[model samples]
Target: MPLAEIPLCVWRKRGQDFVFQGQAIRYWVAGQGEPLLLIHGFPTASWDWHYLWQPLAQRYRVIACDMLGFGDSAKPLNHAYSLLEQADLQQALLAHLGVDQPLHLLAHDYGDSVAQELLARHYEAGVEIASCVFLNGGLFPETHRPVLTQKLLLSPLGWMIGRAFSREGLVKSFRQIFGPHTRPSESELDDFWSLIDSHHGPRIMHKLIGYIPERRVQRERWVSAMQRGDIALRVIDGEVDPISGGHMVERYRQLIPSPDTVLLPGIGHYPQIEAPMQVLTHYLTFRDDLVSPPRKAACS
Candidate 1:
């Protein structure tokens, strides 16, 4: 399977679009219905949803974008890829698309951080949020254990490593992130590498880590916002994920009362890629549960 032939059936390269900040933002949109925004994590493009797009697009308006410094999106070296900046860009993208309606947010990894910031702002503004589905990722920095690569990238040594990122290194990093999951097929690995091989790719990697602030300061606020009951929240965690394991799930449940949490055994971090069918099924179940008619009050 050559990298080009990996079958990105759902996401098409729709090209660039002008928004408030600049024209550097690029995104792909597919399907139709209540808007469903899929935000990818650090070091990966919207292609993270390659396996997830088609099935999800079939039922909902799926929009996946390369964050400012990643994928086809323009990378401005001078700009800071902070969480607040990313959230603002995402909001602008949605507003540009005329998706004023409440949205269902599906995010993983660093995306979870960005989405948290976005939802927090929205919650403060009293905006409607259809639902939020968080996959394997560290939402709270305090609870997050940074991997060796993450620690290096956030350190002064990051520039050197960023500059040294090679195809070999990229593949190795991908494998490490996948942890116990079977090695991605050569072609799949190549596809991921090619995307990161783009200009300033390594530099963007460095910036992404800097984007997340110390979570201790904001953790309680995020937890409180999610528990507000007005917004529906659920989590689908990869049981074996090294970065965000069952411990993170317990923390989430503790903070957000009655959070719907699903543990996928045998799956690692990237559930969307590793278990597309299962991920889709859970998403559909969540969606249906939302629209299902509430049972009449039990006879008093």
Candidate 2:
């Protein structure tokens, strides 16, 4: 599918739009071969894939979109942001692009929730997904350890906390989850703050964070998606993350059959950003295994 030009053009830097339910969200598509969809975490835009985008594009038709209410997309204050809607948005984007072929998914954090929802839908008659690769995320709500700030934001007075949210608070929260050796630098933190500065904090954060609790309510559907063997699965995680670190990986091994996992010891949350090359290696290895011919026994 053409990445641009119906009413707007799509570019790596100046991305174009795809309207979903009348809301225009930014999306980027590049390269060729089977499609590979990238879904980013909460409070961060699709720019999270910048580190690995070009390299990945070399092998597959890489597609990424800034979900509604995130990035440069229209973040209406009245918008009802939920993982269900986000999953629907992804399916719609593929359909709009006329992608009938089985595609792949690479998702992180909140995007994990969206991916799980899509995986559940995979058992139905719809867009066929070849496989999925997960980064650090709360696949199991029981294991997720939201920081104090996140907990406060989900509280009754979250609006008040949101009003008081500051860059310092964000920095502190980020540093907490990130590995001690891999903290966000000033410039990087600035870019992150800028993206969410307006939409982040305030009631917008409160609304967006609703996904945390929703995870609990729909825990069965999502967690079960992982166990169903519906699609090939791989998890590349930052083991040190206080949120869903190595512990989550252990849980996955216990639940998923013959789980495929890559554990980055020093990395924290944001593996693609912190350890781009490593994440790329593990991801490509997994995808390659999917298409490669199985090795046969030597002739006697």
Candidate 3:
């Protein structure tokens, strides 16, 4: 589907109300049954899940929203979009959705960081998590090597750089996220650019990058909690993604015992866009595994 063809206006108009840290949030809700919340990464909005949503929604209550500053959601300049704040916002959104039972979480890029904070908070509150599917990001800042653009955006002078850049520069920056097998079509690129062209795009971009917390002692604590037997964590990684490929998977494996990892060859950072089929397959298999009966113990 083309970007221009997307019913973003209609979706925004129909969004349900939610409160995030004293601010109101607008989110899209569709389907029914076990809840499945999909969170997008930087620059883009919930539209990132456009392809995967329909199929997934057929069997799950799909919820995808534009994180505070992105898409048609409320963009409050007063609030700093920190990871902690985003997590709290997601928590409030869930409460508004009446999602009290354990549910699956699908997160990519920065969304993973937000999920980490939510999972940590839930664990502390003794809440149950059915499963978590992490794609392309694990929030291990110590191990992450940000690209030059990332560094620029996260720096103090990000606002100037973002405001001064051209459309070609924006396209070039986005190209870095794809793999050799997947070059985003012109329409897709235009859609991304349009979203970034939205109000306070540059400022929001800067805050998004700047707000990521540095890896600290808490990393070990969160990793330990995620490793607990009760939580089923799986990772779907794009092999060609320089940002969070093999090394990130290795780190996750070392920290979390028996994490189900799938490597997609010839695909890069955005697996949902580059390799949607692979992503969908992995998600379905993981979901089935969670619902399926466990193998009987071997007889003595």
Candidate topping TM-score: 2
Clashing pairs in 2: none
Error of 2 at 177 (Å): 1.1
Ranking by lDDT: 2, 1, 3
List, residue by residue over 1-300, the lDDT tens digit for candidate 1. 211222543243454566547646768788989899999987777888877776787899998788878876777666666766777778888888888888889999888887787678877883456889999888766667667777788788887877777778866666665637645788777677767766667766776678556455667777667777776677888777777867788777677766688888777778888777777778778787887853121100
RMSD of each: 4.5, 5.7, 4.3
Write down the TM-score for model 3. Answer: 0.88
TM-scores for candidates 1 onward, in order: 0.90, 0.91, 0.88
**Compared with the true structure, what per-residue lDDT tens digits does model 2 show for residues 1-300?**
212111111233568798999988888888999999999998778877877887888999988898988876767787778999998899888988887889799999999998888887877555577899999999999889998988998999887887687778879899888888878788778777766764443447778889999899888877787788747899999999989999998898888876888889999999888888888888878887777754221110
Q: Which runs of model 1 end up more than 4 angstroms from their true locations?
A: 1-12, 214-217, 293-300
Instruction: Rate residue 260 of model 2 by lDDT.
Output: 80
User: Which of the two candidates, 2 or 3, achieves a greater TM-score against the reference?
Assistant: 2
Model 3, 1-300: lDDT tens digits are: 321233445445666766666655657788888988898887677777777877787899998777878766666665666776677677777777788888689999878877776678767883446778888874686667666777887778887776665558667776786797697887777677666666656555666675455435457666666777577777888877888877887787677665678888777788888888788888888788776764221110
* 2 or 3, greater by lDDT: 2
